[model samples]
Target: MTSPGGAAGTRTDPTGTPHPDPTWGPLYRAGAWSALLFVLLVLVPVVLVVVAPLPPTRGAALLEYIAQHRVVYLTELVSFVGLAVPAMVVFAAVAVALKGVDQSIAAIGGLFGVASEVIALALGSSPQSLHGGLVVLSNAYRAADATDRPALASAAEALIAATNAVSWAGILTAAAILLLSLPMRRASFFGPVLSTLGVLAGAAGIVSEALRPVIGSGYMLYGLLLPIWFAIVGWKLLHVSTARAS
Candidate 1:
């Protein structure tokens, strides 16, 4: 990898594309702005879930608004438009300029991440398993204070756990594109690096309490660290795009 700056940073492939760009002024500017946009796209919900207190009144109503208002859909739509589309355009332009580069892998990583993330999110919501991990834990506590039987409670807890596990895996996959971008040593490196650590922590956490899952906090802890990473990544990528245009 090139040093942060200076002589060694000049290393480039045999064909002679400068590692830092002969004129990095524009590229660095682009990287900064792109990262900012990424941060905003990712931070809205995280702040709601984190810095802000749980609405306590979370219920079907919230879910209903999420659906009817189409908040998630709109948010995703904007990102797809203003963020992803722009990124692909830049990827193509850069690849053409480099001449010897293949754009396939980067494209695939982004596409696969979209697919896996969607699948994971869907699976987490599916009600197919009545006796899954999440339900089990919820019912367990309920049973302790109420009349629910062990079998029913156990089933629910398992479903809850399974969903939690699957969700984390999906998140890791969704973040895969960001993580894989690491090898590129792109202008936006902070987001992927931090997100990768979160993935590891999440996967390791689920593995830890597989047998006698207590009121767990492993996943909670892991989720806590992601918001900042998102902010920085979005901003960097947005800025990078702008820089390239200039």
Candidate 2:
């Protein structure tokens, strides 16, 4: 039997396994590159943190650290918040590629993914780290008088607390990954191993975000798994795009 693309030689075979329309080659290629970028963005902050551990979450200490390590702080901030950019692209491409497997699920997952990215971008922080307004607060704290410093410090602390607090953005992100993985498991293109990893990563991500206050460093489990999964997915997408092109 011929595939939906109306060509016997297209990626989809007689068994009815779904494949993306070859017309989506450009988007797939962009997504492939975005996936790699996402992985790099995830890794950079992790490595930076390991090399120069973040300051205590305390307002005064955090402010001082930001002042002293402005470069490092900004780099980490850019990496952390910038994640949404590539993530959005990857999610879009994945949604299009996987739509053939399950249209409704793919669309839902894509919306969740995009929503999470938007939230993260707006908030400018993640469950693991907080940076958004601290730099400006730090400068103000440094320039203020002794009495005024206290208020600025207090404000900074509030920002820190808010940033570290449990967030729906993280939860939605986990859900997106999980939802997308469901279709992936049934789709021949993604296969079982990748889908399994996605399921695990998504589940772990939700749990980590939910229990971050109690688990502390344990959140690293999800953090570590995420990049690994993205890296593999990115490589696969790259191959798919190349094959379609040729």
Candidate 3:
């Protein structure tokens, strides 16, 4: 059942050593199911971040979005648990077939990211980072009203710093593992370069979050890099796995 491409799956590395593919390989990306999930992973946060930058004339909308965040994040939790969580288990079920390096590492990344995400959520952004910085930013009206209370703003900024630190730890660890496994030719290629970007982005985000007074977008944006890159890696993995399978 080996594919025609000389079994890149079985092909030895430059050192002439064979690396076996995983049992189940990459998931069959039939439609855009994986892509949709990827979008969901990235898009929800994007929406949340966008909403944050918006004025609070839309308090109702912001609240709605927060509610939506619960839904999306909860869904994310379930999916990660159901689909992504047990990836590490070396089970004997009919699963985990043909899992190559790409699938293996990408799966690891997803699970890592998800675990971190859930943790960050459990802590609550405000409690971790600036208290209600997101809320304040999202509601321009609130921000405008609170302009006189610089102390609240400082407290909020402090909160952002704290929360983002935790968030970045997860992301940075995940990125390191995923990217290092890629073994790409160039440093700028998608899979190979993504981890680097993830590391830098995650670091920058942490720094920015920690030093709110210095003023830089912290976790506010570090997240943006992982989803798009990691998502694409997830999608690309199937193709790679499929090609190997064929």
Candidate 4:
């Protein structure tokens, strides 16, 4: 059998191949931090804004709520827009870290992950558009007569629905990262547990997202585990990489 790649003093298998090196600690750490940022900056804000009582489902209630909470909606829109940059960094870091183990899988998986995120961001609401829509709604709510309110409410619903459509992209990104775990299972840098968890979590996550419309939000339980898994894997990668360097 061929040896895994590693540092000068690293032990080799019976065939005299060194283990794969975890020399990419910095990249892993960066990936971890970026992933955490996605949780904090993008995910958290989304959850808060969505789960909040900013608007009830009824038409007049929703209009009144948006009029009262325009700032909150504006802030959430800005947060979503800002997510694109950190998301790119997170995917790129993951790809580089994976490259340290297996290059081909990393390239393909990483490219797909980044592409998924980009597509989601592109197809989703833009900050300016969201902000503009909110401005129009707020102004219309304040100035429009009772007869005009229905059109404004319809516009608001359309905007919210458009934003919600991007949820699939998040699932696709998770699936792409999990694909790299297939190689991680065999690589010396990461063993069976991480890879196994990656696959399970990824699969569950994909299912959760796919069934979300049907389940009516129950899938978030599985969805929430995704970031936690990422954080754990990232932490392990950082530790192992630093250890290898020493």
Candidate 5:
């Protein structure tokens, strides 16, 4: 059958739906795998946190907790920070896939998604996690004299406060997802269900992040919805790739 673009050698599925352009095969595959990877990375820290709750936010308690639970602490750090890596790929792929529906919105969404990942990775810590700088301070706090201990502890507290403060990275991420969902609603491949989920997840993320200071732990809603959305998106993308391959 002829492609919509009247191109030669265009493959069609059993139901006569034309396969996506072969040029996009690699990107689809990459996005599929990365989306799954993002889910795994997110789950690791979440499970670890449930198994071993994070230490108190106080500088002294936090330092001691990290010292005692070094392995768990470090694992969480790796997982939370690593999320940005796969997320960037997924965002790029989704943007390209939906660009046909609305190029301007797609570009804006992709930009927000990319910028969020870059900012998060650059920060090297999330609101609930400690920065790498605090790890160094923890070691120093342990080794310092009594007088020095207070100063070091104070410094650690300052770092924690700064890291936990609300930032634009998360807001942009939510905006990206919300904007992308708008285009997805117009794309047959994504359809209404995925688009609806994206809208919920994005709205939840925005509300949770924005009100986190006032509504502690409410952000869990966004956290839970995000992985679910990613999982579905990943599976769908994989299906698309497999169809193309067949």
Candidate 6:
């Protein structure tokens, strides 16, 4: 049986094992607004651009730059910390909102979204791994004679390979957006046009990330599309009245 005043099949949680809660509707909308602000202010600008800057030079030169500019290193750590909490909340919020319409798709999409953030946070910071590797390599290269060149190069190559492995997180995030957008397309707030854009953004992200090796820095293209998609969704959520959500 359905909870009083709740639409049939609305569950209290994404797992759908418990009773439905009509009250969660407003909470999901509020979470959407919070996520929107995070995308606009933090994720797009600081996490993407600042934390992941273009390498001015490859090999020794790049290492040297990283060693000298400690701020870049520190910023990477800070970005991960700053992004972790909001990212989790936003994705969870998206999950809750999506569940209101399509529970199965929402559950899958939410997992993908969470995986994306978790991978980034898990690998992005650890001084002993990527961050520490950079500093250690830079310092070693600085002190090493010509005879040690080959060893340093090999180590750097290994580290770079490991770094690229994290790109799959982007693919997961794209999948989440694509799945979430499907239900939004049917919603009155998103409609066809904005929902179509959301679909396009997700598709672009998937393609860009998949072809990253071939296209080099082409994955950055999603940066342009995603903000717009996020803004549209966030705006709709922000303006949606509590009564409508309930």
Instruction: Judging by TM-score against the true structure, name the best candidate.
Output: 2
lDDT of 1 by residue, 1-246 (tens): 333332433334454433433344344444455545544544554444465333211222222233343444344334433443333333232222222122354445445444554554444342112122333244344435445445544554444445334444334443443433433443222234544653554344344324213435554443444334434444543443444321
By TM-score rank, best first, the candidates go 2, 5, 4, 6, 3, 1
Model 2 Cα shift for residue 128 (angstroms)? 4.2
**101-169: candidate 2 lDDT, tens digit per residue:** 777888999999999999989888865446768999999988988989989989988888888888888
TM-score of each model, paired residue for residue: 0.41, 0.93, 0.45, 0.74, 0.90, 0.72
Per-residue accuracy of model 4 over 114-143 as CA lDDT, tens digit each: 887787677645421343455567677779
Backbone clashes in model 2, listed as residue pairs: none
Model 4 stretches astray by more than 4 angstroms:
1-26, 46-54, 58-60, 78-81, 124-136, 166-168, 244-246
Model 1 CA deviation exceeding 4 Å by range: 1-105, 124-162, 168-179, 186-215, 244-246
lDDT for residue 115 in candidate 3, whole number 0-100 = 55
lDDT per residue, candidate 3, 113-220, as tens digits? 455545544444421222234454434434455554454445444544554443443543344334433432121222446445545554655455445444544454
Query: By descending lDDT, how would the candidates be arranged?
Result: 2, 5, 4, 6, 3, 1
User: Can you write out model 5's per-residue Cα lDDT over 137-173, one digit (the tens) per residue?
Assistant: 8888888889898888888889888878786888888
Question: For model 6, how does the per-residue alpha-carbon lDDT over 115-188 read when each residue is reduced to its tens digit?
Answer: 88787676664211234566678788878898996678677767765665437776887787888788776555
Q: After superposing candidate 6, which stretches have Cα over 4 Å from the reference?
A: 1-22, 25-30, 33-37, 40-54, 76-85, 125-132, 143-150, 240-246
lDDT accuracy of residue 102 in candidate 5: 67
lDDT of each: 0.39, 0.83, 0.41, 0.63, 0.81, 0.62
